[model samples]
Every structure is written in structure tokens, then in C-alpha cells.
Target: MADTGAAIELVGLTKRYPGDRQPSVDGVTLRVDAGETVVFVGPSGCGKSTTLKMINRLIEPSSGSVRINGEDVTGLDPVELRRGIGYAIQSSGLFPHLTVAQNIALVPRMAGWSGRRVRARVTEMLELVGLDPGEFRDRYPRRLSGGQQQRVGVARALAADPPVLLMDEPFGAVDPVTRGHLQDELLRLQRELRKTIVFVTHDVDEAIKLGDRIAVLGERSRIAQFDTPEAILAHPADAFVSGFVGSGAALKRLDLTRLRDLGVPGCPTAHQGEPLPQVRARLRASATDEMLLLDRRGRPVRWLRRADLTHAEGPLTEAGTPVGGTVTRDATLREALEAVLTDSTGRVAVTGPNGVYAGAVRLEGLLGTVRGLLAADRGRAREHQRERESTRPEPTPPEAEGATAGRAEGDAMGSAG
Candidate 1:
């Protein structure tokens, strides 16, 4: 179950409808490895949905093939194939008439599982999606909130333990807060389940957050670029990919990027009750202009400038004098950037959830991470270019004059006749 491998593959896939001058999807070829999540992203009407639907035969392809688990699924019965794969949509699509358990059990029941097995599976799925089975199983969709219904949608999709999951904007219908929660939940689930997931979304942020790899779709369903989220964000293929990724890509990079990559040295720190001279001495020892003041419990309180020590303040025990912004250690690079921008000091205090001083992040460290990311991206690009050049067919050398003479004479005689 762990190593199913290449759960879905599309080779030269194209789909065209009647009277259409252009194909909806033109020769799309991509593969999704088992236990990996790939997100297809593009502007409206870019044929991403059509490409996904073709995988389960929801929309038949005009040509080419769709294979699941190394088997060509294009010829398989569409209904049976879909039943074995998990499918979730924007609106949850739960049946209001049925209880939550019944809605979740729909697929298992359709597959002719015994009622006891179906019930057990339904209960498991409900728990998996963060809904208590005892409470939500008997409740109808109408009794749940938008977020709740979407959770139910995910539960129903996983009811039969499908190895492949197809999600088409599954959280699109929920509010921003709920959408974020659902995204985190899905990430947690994916970490545990390791299902091969194909998630389609137009949100670049979401794509960067959830996708192990991203397929950037362009007009006519052409794949502009396919790579890991970090690579895609760092090095977009063209103007379309760049614009689609949006203006704040550098800042967004922080969200996907981590702080550990940035080599940040420790800054001088002092407790609140420390003498002013001692604080000044620590600041001078660190060769820095300011010192971070920590509370009695060694939690960050505020920053103290060297000049402030010159005043009559007996100690640097100031309660709250321009502490600046603080961020958690796990906060994305993007959030750190925002904190730096909003604060005047261009520095952010890193603290744990329990309010313990973890470390500090300065503009220098942040810049270093960005540079490292960009450098790695450029290296990859050069390698890809080299690969393409080496793989390209070389031209044949010119032949001797007599080599094609007979063929040329025959062609001339045929044309004359």
C-alpha cells in the first residue's frame, strides 16, 4: 500500500468537443506518484478540470490514454472506476436527505459492502475528518455549518479507503478561516494516509501550501511548468507563470521556506532586572547598537537602544517601550517578512507558543534565505537546460554526392509523368 507508484499517468491526452476549433486539453502528459499530492493550477477555462475529470473518465478524452496504477483506465467502466476512487468537490455535495453517516457511507454501500462494514468505515472516516462520529453521524447536512459540511465531503470521499483521491477545489466553498483550517487538516491526513492525491485549485497560495509538486497549466491545458512548490515559486517558467504566481512571490516564498536554512547568529540579550551598565556591556560585547530585553522569566519584552542607557534610567526594566513585532519559530518566512516590514526595527522576536524566547530573526538572516533559495533555483534551471540540450537529436552529416542521386532522378521522372 505504501509503494503503489505512479498512481495516475496521462500520455498525450487531448480532449475536443464537437464544433470546437481548438482542443480543450492538448496533449497533456503528466504523472502523479503514489503518496504524492500534485496540484493543477491556472486561470479560468484553462482545462485543468477537464484534465482531472478525464482521469476517472468523467469526461472522455478524444485521444490518448489515462492510466491508474499502471493500468489503462480509459476503457474501464466509468462508474465502477469512480466508485473505487475518492472524489470531492467545492460544495461538499452532501445529500441533505441522508444523515452524515449515510452520506459518508454512500460509496461503500454502492460498492455492496455489508451494512456493518459500511457503518464501521463511516465512523472511521468521520473521526478522520475531525468530526466526532457519535455526535455528527446522526446529524443531517443541514444541521452542520459550511466547514462542517466540507469535512463531511472529505469523509465521504475517503469512506471506501480509495488509493487515489481527486479533489476539485474541495475547500473553495468555505470562508477563508475555515479554508485554512481544512487545508491544515488535509496536510495532516496526507502525512498519515499517503494517498496519491490530485488536487485542482486556482489559488496559487493554496497550491504552494499543499502541493508536493505543482503542474502550472496554461491555455489549452498545456503544462507550462511542473516542479516542486519551492522550485515553481522561486523560478516560474514564463511571464504567464510569473504573473499567475503573482506580485508577492518573494514574500510568499517565505511561507514555503523555512528559517533553519538562514544562518542566524545569536543576538545579545538581557533580563529586565539587569543593571543598565551590565546591559550596555553585553550590547558592546556583541558589537551591536541595541539589546533585546527579556522579562523576569526570560521571555522577550522590548528592545533597548544603546542611547537609552545614557539617560537616568536606573535599570533597563522598562515595561513596554517599542518591543517590535514577534513571530513564532515555525511561522513562515513570508510572515517574518511582513513582521519586519511592519516594525520599525526591521527585526522580529521569535517566541514559542508558551511565550518563551526562542530566537530572533533579522533582515540579514531573511535576505540570506532568499538568496540561497534563488541560487538553488538557478542551479536547477541550468541543469535542466543542459539535460535538454544533451537529449536533443543531433543533425546528420552531409552525404556524398552519389548517395541520393538515384532517388532524386526517380522523383524528377515521376513529376514529369
Candidate 2:
């Protein structure tokens, strides 16, 4: 599978049903940059799905062109074009009779990959989506949970390493908790793969969470506003866009920033198998009363307090309260805030790949970050207002026009003198 991310452009894309008075999608022109995730969000029946399918010619655009990476794909054979574009839909869309490995191998096989290569890709993709190839490869779809099935669906989509991925409410069928996990997984994958993604969903928050840019659609697939989540949240284009943004625009801004962007400071720490005397000495020297315990692999295990050290005659692993609240660096600020608020500790542990300890985020830091973000947004809004005012064409009053011209001429003469 090639590691490629392609730019997608739609020019005047329209879709009409036979004998219908209005087209389902009318003149939707959008550009999704390579390695960007662009989400299409709108009310139900707004033709977001129809517009998504037209990219692969599944719905077949009635007019306009679909270009991938610079080449026009509208004239290309639908089958070959689809082979290059990964599409995943709602409900996992897995063939129930087929095993997970078989389902994932479909695309690679269609491209004439050898059996060994297809098998290797199947294993690689499953692992890429956090599924164990040994455990899940041979299991039928019926044997898997909704979340597991969705992971397999994603694995299948990426098996051939398509440059572009089209996902239509792929996580909508799962429970809220599972949906969140899937969203987090997608973010992690995007960070690594950087594929161009066009995602369709009616959930505004989801769009804000996943998209690099969001296209808010209205009737007949009219794009009301297309911009970054921060821009749209700070300044909606119109009433329709504002209504779609709903309340909590400020909180939604938190999703635009990730924990990695903030410099998460490290706290005092101790390893599990360290000597009890050494651990006691370190804890006494530490500024804080608490220390984070890590396993041999450097993953967070427990939080040790100064008092717990006195009673610990044995291994440090069997000491202090178990570390409960944890978040990955890929987690958004909102998620980190939620974890910190729920935990008894004022801070939450941040981890990297394979649960390795990265750093920690404190409540005070998050509060300060949020305040800074709001202040910056306000500043940008003011600047945009100034720009608009400067560029605006002001109409001259009929009576004042002659006076204004005379005043301008006098000012010019005074400057010359």
C-alpha cells in the first residue's frame, strides 16, 4: 500500500433526481487539501450524503467535475476511480458471512495484490485500527461488537492505502462512549497517515471535533459557511450557520486545540521496581507531596503520596491510590478538562502511544489556556471587523458629495503648499 494523500476538488458539483423540481445537491464547490479532513455537516435531508457519494460516482454527479490530486476522475472508469478512493459507511457495512480478514482483503485483491501481500495488509490494517490480527482476523462480523465491527470497516477502507477516504457517519451507530473512542482512534490515525478525508455527518460537534475545515450545508446542498472550526465558531457566516453552531460555541473551541499543542509539564515520578529506601528519599526531596508511579515500560501505574511511602515496606507497585484519570496527548483540551475535573487530583496524566507516560495537565493551566484562547478569538474578531470596515464601499450623500469633493481638493492644495 502506497503512503499517499491526495487533494480533492469539486467544481460546480450537482446531483438531480429524475423529474425532481430541485437538485439534491446544487453547485457545491469544495476543496479538501491533501492530508486534511473536511467535514460536511447539515440537517437531515440536506443531501450531504448524496454529495459525498458523487465524489466516487456512486451517486454520479449530474454536472461538474471531481478531481483527485489534480487529475479529473469524472471521466475515469467508476470502478478504477473507486478502487483508489476508500469509502466507509454507517453500520460498519461488513458482509456478515465473511471473516474480518476476508472483508479487509477485498480492495487489495481487486487491485491484483498477491495473496501474501493481501494477507500482510489485512494484518497491518487491523493493527492500525487497534485490533489484534491474531484475535480478530478469522472472526465473522456477527461475532464482533458494534465498535469492533466499525474498526474492521475502517481497516477495510484503508487496506489498500487509498489517498482519499470518504466516511459517512461511520461512528453514528455506536454508543456514545464507543463513538468517542472511535473518534479518538481516527484522530490518532490521521496524525500518522495524513490522508485526505471527506466526512459526512449531521452532528455539528462531531464536525468540529474531526474536521480541519467544516462545510455547513443548507437546502439543495448549498454551503452556508466553509471555514476552520475556530473561525466558524468565533464568527458564523449567517443566521443559518449560527443556528447550526447552536450554543457552547466557546466550549466547542476547545476541540480545535489538542493537548500536544500545550506544553504539558512533567511531575515527580518513580518506577515500580525501585528500592523502597531510594523511593522514600526521592519523595522527600520532591517539591510536591505526590509522585506518579510508572511501570517498567514507563506507563503510568499509580499515584504515590508521601504518607504512603512510610507504610511501604514492600514493592512500590502495591502502594497508593490507583491512577484513574488518564488521557492521550492526541486528546483535545475539552477532554483533558473533563478528565481533570472528574478525578480527585487537580491534574490528569497524559500518555503517548502504548500508554507510555508523556506528561500531565493541571486544572489551572487549562483554565489559563481557555482564557487565552477566548481573548485571542476576540482580538481576531475585532481585526476582521476593522478589515471589513476599511474595505467597505461607503455611499456618498447627494448633498454632501460636492462638499466632500471640495474638502478633498482643499486638503490636497494644503498638502502641496
Candidate 3:
């Protein structure tokens, strides 16, 4: 199956139910590029779920356009449209009577794949979702845990290799720890599969962590704001957006990237044969009271303070303070911050998978990265606002041109400054 991600576009999309005073989803226009995972987030009763269902024609729109890869799919038969797109809902949605293999093979079977091909596809998808086909192929749905069942639902959705996937709070039924595990699994699969995904969730942090971009909705399903998580967190579109972001928005954005991605600096280190003056230079140059002492194989010995930098002027040894806690490269900035705060020394030591020292990060470095991200986000928001204002159809009075120019110039200077 050709499963390349397809771009989805919705234009003037509106949905109104019978006897309703207003449409559930107003005229909302948005485009999702190929391979992009867009999260729709808002309060309950918002049109986010309605919007997601419309993509696969689960819920027919009152009037609007739904296009996939530039082809108008709004007119396509609902059943055919849905069969080609993957959909995963809140619960696992597995058939109680069907074994795991049969459940996963349902879609391919519908598509007229041969028995042998269906079996192979089922095995591939089960393994793709991290379930062992040998063990789980014949197990009934009731025999699996909530998380495992959700994985089966996901695998079943992909059995036919659909190009697009729609998920609606698919992890909502599990416990918090299980939900986190499922979320991580989805992230892992997304990296390998790159399916065009429309994910619906009410949690801002989840949206921020999972989405390449997010669409925040308001009353009647209108888009309150649509942008990347960083820009939205740094410069909310209005008071409504700010309030919805809740508290600690900065920390939420900080969680988006791990510590190693920031390229944190390593601590000054001396091997077993380094000169005394060299060790002293490194310690003083670092402006820290202690430095890392290494054994012959380049692992941390102990904290060698400037007071103990002499020590016979030979290779550094075991006479130093105990090292503080270590952090891994994959740890979030929140964890990195914790490590930095709790460390006895000023640095947060980083370790690789082999338990060998990789690098070190200082609190100041983390702060600097946060500041840089915030500044860039604000700048992007301001630039986008200006471009929107510039594109307005209203013509300015001739006399107002001077003021507009001045404002534009001032904005440019402000951006530069």
C-alpha cells in the first residue's frame, strides 16, 4: 500500500445540527501539510472533535470543502472515504469475539487482500505497534490491558496502511502513567510512520508536546488562535488565549525540547597524566571552585576543588568531594533544571547510555536557552500580526500614510533592537 502522508485542507467548514440556533463549527479555514501532525485543542463542546470527524466523513459537514492532496473529497462516499483513512477513538473499540489477529486483519480483509497477505500484514502491524504477534495474535480483547488494547486499536487502524490517521482522545481511558506510556508509544510510531494525523485533545500540554502546530478553538468551533506551540505560549493572541494557556506557560514550552538538543557544555576535565598547572588553569578558567577528575578510561573520579588542585601535580586522583546526581541526554529541561538545582556542584553532569560522562549543563545555560526561545517566539508572533494587518483590504486615508509608515518603521526598529 502507498501510505505516504496526504495534505488535508478545510475551507469555510461549518456544521449545523437540526433545530440548533448556531452551527457547531463555524466557517473555519485551515490547511494541514503532508506528514504534519496537527492537534486541535479546546474545552468540551468545542468543535475540535467535529472538525476531526469531518476529515474522514465520520460526521458529514453542513456545508464546506474537505480536500485531501488537492482533490475534493467532500463528495466522496462516506464509507469509501472512511475506509481509506485510519480512525482511532477513545476506547480500544475492539470486537470482543474477535481475536487480535482477526481484529487487525479486518480492514485488509475488507479491502480484499488474500488470506496470506492479511496474515502477514497483521503480523507486521502488531510488531510495528510493539506487540508480539506470536503471543498476541490469538488473544481476545478482554485478555489485554487498557494500554495494550489501545495499541491494538492503533494497529488495526493501520492494517490497511492508510495515509491519514484521525485520533480522538485515544489515550483518555487509561490511568495517568499508562496514558503517558501510550502517548510515548504514539510519538515513537509517528517518528517511524509519519502519517498525516489530526489529533483531538483538550489538554494544552499534550497538544504542545505532540503537535507540529496546534489549532486552539473557541465558541461555535471558531479558531481562537492557530500557530506553533512556542509562538502561542510566548505571545498569546489575546486575553482569552492567555487564560486558556493557564499558568506556567513558559515551563510548558520549556518541556518541548530535551537538554541534549540544546547542546549543553561539558565540564572541564583532567586525565591521569595532566600537568598540575593545566588542572589549575582549567579550574580557574571555569570560574568554578571544583573540576572533574577522570580515571585512565575517561570516567568521572570525583570533584577536585581548586583547594585540592595541587595534589602532587600528577594525574588527578580519588581525593575529592563526591559527585552529585547525573542526568541523561534524553531528559526534559524540567528534569535538567531539577538536576542543576539539586547538584552539590554548579554543573549538571550528563551521561550517555553507557553510563559514561557525556557533558555538563549549567543553570545559567538553561536560562539563556529559555530566554532565546521566548524572544524568537515573540518576534515571530509580532511579525505575523504585522503581516496580517498589512494584508487588510481597507484602504488607509492619504494623510494617515505618514503615521502608518512611522509605525511600520518603529516596528522594524523595535524588532531589530
Candidate 4:
């Protein structure tokens, strides 16, 4: 998600309940950019919920300031501020007495919208959430399924077109299938609306899936790490973050991974009309050590190693040597890794749908791609650090003789006088 310049800044935010020895949120300082979704994730009582609530003044911070869009909101009128922000919680908190349209239109009405405006907004939001306005407008929450009610709750959250959205376990109470559907719907909605969203969840997978960046919290409400999903998975900050990410971090990475970013490069091909010797010569010139044998139609027939060709009884033909197992282009890196590990050959032949050779994929190339990606990542991190250092105010250098001609002349004149 691109940062839209909308931000929620917490400056040393802390919260302590009466009689509690430890703060629910302790010395937390974070910035959630505009039009970006930042998920707060951790175990039970990690202060994720408390932190989320504090964003909209649902829970007051024990100390420090909360700023939204660069304005200090710590002392803002809670009712007025919340009315301008979207809020959704577990169980799709809809009023049973109100119809779906009425429920979704609550915020607009509260904001002093006229009847026609409210009706138009209700229709628009229901359509936005994949619900037909005509089909569900008059239906009450009690008449709708749990999933439908939650969808309506989400629609209601967007009714007023609020710039910021606070969601606390919005889909947690739903079944797995419903949750998955809602997740996809939410992603689609976010892509279109680009709301500045602060989402709190205990599910790490959900956080990884939904968040542009995740803030992983620890016990006593401490933030262990906050970073992109790929960075967090590839290089966790510490043991706590790693364990929190779980054992299948590699598999989770697949979701963020792309085949175009991996290592599969074009290789030399043998033409059908070219003589066997010509093909062999081309292979030697290419310096691949092995040549792929292609048929008259330019489809791979077999692999001919240099050693096999040197000891050949006659000119090479399709029957001379044959290739073995092949993999497809869309295969996962995990699959490619397995193929490289199990095969006797160091390289795997990548083919197309009809078994035509696409290109060659080698372990070395894969390693190279990984190394390049990592180096680029390191460079970016160093650049970011440098930028941060530059942005910080530097201390003035101590005054010294010869550094200022004026100071030296004044000192000399004073001494003479």
C-alpha cells in the first residue's frame, strides 16, 4: 500500500489500569501512515486491543500524545472525533431493531445527513460490500446470517466515508470459511478505498495477510518488532518474533513471493534443421557443458552431456540421448528447491504446458537471485537509516580557534586593549 500521508502518531503512549502493577501499553511510540493498514498482533492481554481503542479515544492513554493527520487528538472531544472515524468490532454490532439499510446508515444519520443522502450512502455501501441494496436493505440483522451481518457492519463503517477506520477482531467471531471470504472482501475494499486502517488481531496469519506492515507485540504490551511481512519472515528481529511468526514462516512467504522475482533465465535452443555437429558446436560455444536435444518441431527430446557426446558411436539423433523429469514455470520455489535436491543433475529443465522446454533453472541462479534480493534489501535499510540520521537535528560543533576569523580577531583586539 502506498503511504497517503495520513498518519496516526503515538508519542510514548502508555496505559495503566487501577491496581495493576504493569502498564497495559508501555512506552509505545509508533506511526501508522495514511491509506495504509497496520495490524497490531500479539498474544492475549498484549495490549493490542488497548492500543487500538486508544487510537479513537475508546481507551485513554495514561500519558503522552496521540496525533492524527499531524493534529494532537489526545484532548479532542471523543464523541465528535469518533463520529468522524469508522469503528467496527467483533460480532458485527448491528442494532436488531434496525433494518440492514438503517443499520448501515447509522453513522451518516449521526453525522447530520439528510434522508435522501443517507439512503444513497446506504445503497452505495451495500453495493461496495458485495451485498445487493435492494435484496438486503430492508432485512434486519436478526434475519441475516452472521457473515451477512458482519458484511453489513463493514458497510456501515464505510457509510460516512471516514478517512480512518478502527477495527478490533472484526471477523474473529465468524467461521473459517466466512472469515476467509471477509478477508478477501476487505482486501478488495481496501484497495479501492485506501482508508487509513488500524486493525487489531490475535491471529498472526491474518495480520500478515491484511497488514501492509505488522506490529508484533510482546508480553506487558511491548512491541517486539514492526516491519513488512517479507522482511519479518526473512529476518526476524529476535527469538520472540520468530516464534510468534511460527514454524511455517517459509510457506507463509510464498504468499508474498512472486515467480517473476525468482531465477529462471533463457537458455540456448537447438533448431530442427541444424545438423548434429552444428548443434553440438552451438552447445560448446554456449559453454553450458550440456546441450538440450530438441526434436524437428523444436521440442526437447533429451539432454546430451559433453562426456556422452565425446564417446558417441555416430552423429547425434533423438535416440542418441534422452532427457528426464521436468518442472513447469508456475511451480513454487519450495518445489524447485526439492527438485534440485532430489535430482542427480544440478539444474532442472523448466517446460511449458505442452512439454516444450521454456528455459533452464539452476540452483546457482536461485542462490544468486536470493543473494541479490538480500543485498538490495540491505542497501535499502542502510539508506533508510541514513535518512533517519540526517533528519535528526545534529548538535552544533564546539567553537574553535581558526574556525571563525571574527572570533580570533575579537580575541586579539581584546588582548591588545
Best by lDDT: 2
Candidate 3 Cα deviation (angstroms), residue 191: 1.8
Q: Residue 69 deviation, candidate 1, in Å?
A: 1.5
Give residue 245's lDDT in candidate 2 (0 to 100). 94
lDDT of 3 by residue, 249-360 (tens): 8678666887657886777787777777867888888866766776676666577777787664544565576566766665567667777877755466776533457787
TM-score of each prediction? 0.67, 0.89, 0.69, 0.63
User: Model 4 over residues 1-417: C-alpha lDDT tens digits?
Assistant: 122325789888899899999888898899998888999999988889998888889898889788988888876889888877789999999999999998988878988999999999998898888788889999988888889999999999878888888999999999976775577678768878899999989998788777899999997568899999878886789999999889976566544533434646877667555666776677788857777777665667777777766666554663335656555554445445556666677777776434557787778766665566557666877887888799998765656434677788899999999
lDDT-based ranking:
2, 3, 1, 4
**Residue 298 in model 3: shift from native, Å?**
22
> Residue pairs in steric clash, candidate 2?
none
Candidates 3 and 4 compared by TM-score, better number: 3
Worst 10 residues of 2 by lDDT: 1-10
Higher-lDDT candidate of 1 and 4: 1
Give the Å error, residue 377, model 2.
Answer: 2.0
Instruction: Please give the clash total of every predicted structure, in order.
Output: 3, 0, 1, 2
Score each candidate by Cα lDDT. Answer: 0.82, 0.90, 0.82, 0.78
Candidate 2's C-alpha runs over 4 A off are 1-3, 391-398, 401-417
Best of the two (1, 4) by TM-score: 1
lDDT (0-100) at residue 217 of candidate 1?
A: 98
